[model samples]
Target: MTTFEILNGAGADGDQLAGSLNDALCTAAPMVERISGMPLPSHVTVRLLDVAASQALSVVHLGLVYGMAAERLDTEEAFDLAGKLAATAGSRFRMFERITWPLQLGKILYGPTGPELVVVPAAHRAARTSTRQQTVVMGHELTHLAQLELWPDMLTAGPRLRIKAKLTGQPTKSLPVIAPLFEGHAQFVHRDLAAELCGVRARRRLPGEAAPTLRYRATDWLGAVPPLSMVRAIYDRGEKFVSAVMDAGGRSLVHGLFTDEGSLPLLPELLKPELWLARHHPVPAHNAHDQ
Candidate 1:
């Protein structure tokens, strides 16, 4: 099946993905800790799970993705396509190594909270990690770890998205830009650090293979390429767009889009220029994953 179909939920569970998550964590835990600059609370913990555990989490995340797609494409064929996309996403669950920062997406916790990072295996495999790629992911996740370290304070910046969804009977996706401010900032930090630490040269590449958008690759602030979504049209070009933004402002201002929680819509405006003003300033340089 195509990548989109796979995201809808295709493959069987309890297979290589689970084992890999476990293995990658075992091999990576040390480096993750060393490179991650975020402070770890005394009560914080890290875990490596097999397929059963990963599948459980995958079911929840996949369900969310499918439901979102369903709203946009509610016909039988649409639902079928959605399901396939979920399945594809599920099947490839084996191809990622994710870092689950919070128990729920939008919720924040105080110290003595649950494990801060759930590093998945699938991502490790997809990167075909050499020392370089491993460092990149580690840097990416480490940036996330930094965010998690300060998570409690960060939540105040935006409304709790999941809670809003439940109260309004709206899908989390309905918000148009549902990710927490901290999440957006962390994502940008992760991308930036990963490229520097791992020598990724993200400006030259696109975010993913899905679209035909181009992004700018300037100071490589946050190391992010542009949206490969129908947004950018191509990966390389998307990188340039992003690079120009970095050049105009600084990375932190761009990241503040999520953290600032201003009158703007984060996701949809990802391609717009009004927000580019934030980038007009410069983002202070940070070490790889300066948690």
Candidate 2:
């Protein structure tokens, strides 16, 4: 079950928009589970935030990442030191990018019960985006919730990697692979959910339109000795590689990784998933028990 809290900013249309969001999420939530082959929280509280709350949450997220709040501090001196360094990096160096992140559509909220999902419906209204678009945003955040539930460490990969860079004085070679895997899987899942929402909304087959293809260079994604600094730019690369992996081995490859970490792609295998596929699913077969 999902309960919603609207924290201002819908104006008179608040009730109508809230109704649309509830319906959309009810339909969309299961799609996330089906695609990722993972379970979502039994109950998730969804918050619809206005700009002020959205921006405030962004700062909180950063604070949590960096251990700016004392209770979140770890025992490890290295972890805590790196977190302090991360906080400094964000506040001092990445101000503009930091400013932009809070303006996003939705995010996974960390709460006492579990990870909740939050959206800025007013962001949708201000841009005149459709319910389907807003639903897709919900799906994207929903994927993150699945990630948080199933592989919480994956969500922490970014901050940890930055800390590694701070420690080693160089970016790890795996930067290209890890960052993309984190985001790409969610991007692919949410878009698939978007298409389903569209079909459900229309109650008919989607109209044939030539969807524009997105092209990305392996170099751009793979990067030439990726610097820790390119963290923002390389995340977009994940969807293509994830799509390719799904094409090669299907959702079984995704499902396998959760239970059998051995199947998780080697850092080098991330960009070339076939290498991982050839190793893990070369037989190209799975039974009911596989999932």
Candidate 3:
């Protein structure tokens, strides 16, 4: 039976998917090093196995959610869909290798916390519609690795805080404040790096890309493609603030922004519109088109 049919039947036998996965891992080895800036640990090996094997370790698995499933998600369709999703998410796929795994059909899986990428026996990263897209996915994952490295304690604290807040009845809302800085930075940097590395820029965001106009004010332009006006507002304002600070005092003021020790706490203040504008001196009121 074809691999797709097998996956659709009983749970996948882990061994069935191993070889293809191994091949993909091998091919992506160089890229993993380049983007991560750290060599893979010699002892850390990648193996492709069925769902059961994946379960042995904490795995970020992909599966189809009912209603989310579309008939066109098979094989090439999966790659295409993933490519499109990566574009919206500002990521790309590298390559797909084969493997055997025990999982029903109609799903995709990967560990959000472990290894850069993974696929079941039925789907592997392959030639995407464009190489630029492949780089987008790969770049985003690399940035995720960078985030983990940069903030090793954040994840550990996240769950504990959530649980503690629940048990004690204290509402903990810090994550929302933290999420935008971290996720937004990652999202921005991933797209920036992907475009730089691949030499391709994505299309601008369209009108519907942003939330309803009532919820967000449109301002600033940073990304070449249309971005959610609010998001663009944040980046543009942030960049302008940072630039003005540097222009006045030079890199010393800017370097402080990158300090990892305790500088993270400053992000919220920096993101504030008033502070951002104050850092750059007053200017005549202007719309995006005027600038």
Question: Which candidate has the highest TM-score of all?
Answer: 2
Report lDDT per candidate: 0.39, 0.60, 0.36
Residue-wise C-alpha lDDT for candidate 1, range 1-291, written one tens digit per residue: 000001112133324343433343344344434433344343323333333455456545664546554554445654555566567666655343122211111112221233234433333333333443434443444444455454432332223333334445876554534233334443444455556544653423334423211211121222333321322233233343445554565655444433443423444444454444444343477888986
Q: Estimate the lDDT of model 3.
A: 0.36
User: How far is 113's C-alpha from truth in model 3 (Å)?
Assistant: 10
Error of 3 at 122 (Å): 6.6
Over the stretch 25-140, how does candidate 2's per-residue lDDT look in tens digits? 77778888887777777767776666566556655666565552223334476566656765675465345333333235567755434455666765445444455666676777
Worst lDDT window (10 residues) for model 2? 211-220
- Stronger candidate by lDDT (2 vs 3): 2
Model 3: how far residue 189 lies from native, Å? 2.3
> Which pairs of residues clash in candidate 2, taking residues 3 or more apart in a chain or in different chains?
none
Poorest stretch of ten by lDDT in candidate 3: 1-10
Q: lDDT tens digits, residues 1-291, model 3?
A: 001111221135335444443343343334545533433333222333444443332222222211122223334444444434434322111111112121111122333323323323332221111233334443443444444544544333333333344445767653223334443443444455555544544422323333322211111122223433444455454544444554655544433434342443344455563454354344567899978
- Native-to-model Cα distance after best TM-score fit, residue 178 in candidate 1, in Å: 4.1
Q: Which candidate do you rate higher for lDDT, 1 or 3?
A: 1
